[model samples]
Target: MPTHPHSPAKESVVDLLGMLAYGELVAFDRQSIDARLAPDLRRRAQLSIMAAAEMRNYQRLVARITELGADPQEAMEPFVQVIDGFHDSTAPRNWLESLVKVYVGDGIADDFFREVATLLDPVDRDLALEVLHNDDHSEFAIAEIKAAIADNPAVTNRLALWARRLVGEALSQAQRVAAEHDSLTMLIVEGTGDLAKVGELIKRLMQAHSERMTTVGLNN
Candidate 1:
């Protein structure tokens, strides 16, 4: 049977979906690497479990894309360079950095998805919403970030600087993706109903980051 050509609308939708699928794949890989920064076996295992869940979610998204007649790797290729650079450049040096990475990165991801969800149909939108990291992971991140700061108050200046650097690096990579990938950028703009909304989304992410850091005793 011949496959139908998707309309421009649907193609854009698929691209948006693909970008997200690729995001999940890269996130899984990076988090798996950062998990090694955990101080003990228990903490390591917790991070490993979270990383593995990303893989499972990635698989499901890939399967759905295949059903749409898209190549999983190809669909994700556009995002490869930016995401790869983000992870490589921000690679954590210790348990504290790792926790901050997860907290900040995942918080940013959840914000992005919430913005993108409006572009998708019901099922995929719901899937994106559902795949987000849960409260347990958030709680875990808050606890780890707080404990590390408590153990060494001197750690604050270093880790807070690390967090800001991580955010800067992430934004740099994201700007690259938005410039090079029109479809992905358009997805956010249209999906959220306006270009200005992206800034608001970012502000919300910053607010969340501040709350998370304050909860951890880090100066916001």
Candidate 2:
């Protein structure tokens, strides 16, 4: 029997899936830890629930990777360093900072997933859309951040700067991912056949981020 030719594009797809899976896994872990910083039982439980949701999403991604005949662990190993670095550098010091990190970091990740979903094949695209944050959990974060700002007003400046740093760190890691994964880079560029479309996608993510910041009373 003749062996089937492998699609080079599949390499990018697997890489993308692996990265997302690891992200969901780490997100679950970080959110669980951050929940401990919650000031009260109700808030801590809410954060725990949010963290559980990420774990469920992580399982889904892992199953999908397995379905695609890839070892999830091996696939995710490449991303461990950069992803760990992102979380370590952005570790939140307080409950309010934790909320801001969730709001900013997860929001950007969702926006990036949305942008990439357009370039994926049907199976992968659907999976990407499914794994992206549903926005329900974020309501709590948004509410908390807004309430904190209302209470102090001074923390707004601090969190606004924190949000900017989150974006900066995320972008730095993104550039590293792009440089290391050419096939994934090609997927984004070929999505519209114009390099400028990639720039537009990034601008859209930033625009959405700014709106989210303003929604929570934080200056962008």
Candidate 3:
């Protein structure tokens, strides 16, 4: 009998890919809804474009999972509840809040995956980096947020508070996922070669996140 075309992948890779796949899928859904909250048609259309990009990224991740000989849906299943919970808890109330969520929340996630991608095999690392949110989306969100802050200085306090909440919730969810997924945790530990380095990695992620928050005039 012929064997599968690709070699067996590590469990950590599957978990990472699965989590990312589901994340992309949910991002698409959230972006579509967020687009509706856009104050104007141009902004709404921009979000729609970003949402479509998310779906394409999801498809790419699913294809990669299949190539690894795993069921795409099964790979994504484990993360559904965890990811959904994060979204449910962080639901945005208005256009600016929605943009802040996209900028602050999704920015942290992309930063994390980009860091982790360095620890993966070349193919997986490349794919992970490739599927990340494009600069166009980030630029759009940042511009919108800064413009809002400029128009109404009063908006800063509210958005800054919302961003802080997002970071707190995001960190909590990350801890939950790390605690629950042994293979992924092991991958991080092994890649960094020590528990202390893992701590350093997290610090680096948070530091970068703080910079991003500041970039859009939000207090970290």
**Superposing all C-alpha atoms, what RMSD in Å does each candidate have to the true structure?**
3.6, 2.9, 3.5
Off-target runs (Cα >4 Å) in candidate 3 are 1-9
- Per-residue C-alpha lDDT of model 3 across residues 37-110, encoded as one tens digit per residue: 99899999998998899898899899998988889999999899889988888889999998898887668878
What C-alpha lDDT values do all the predictions have? 0.78, 0.86, 0.86
> Which 10 consecutive residues of model 1 have the lowest summed lDDT?
1-10
| Candidate 1 segments exceeding 4 Å error | 1-8
Write down the TM-score for model 2. 0.94
lDDT for residue 25 in candidate 3, whole number 0-100: 94
Among residues 3 or more apart in sequence or in different chains, the pairs in candidate 1 whose N, CA or C atoms overlap within 3 Å are: none
Across 79-192, the per-residue lDDT of candidate 2 in tens digits comes to 999999999999999999889999997898888888888777777778888887767778989999988988999899999999999999998998998898787788778775
Each candidate's number of clashing pairs is 0, 0, 0
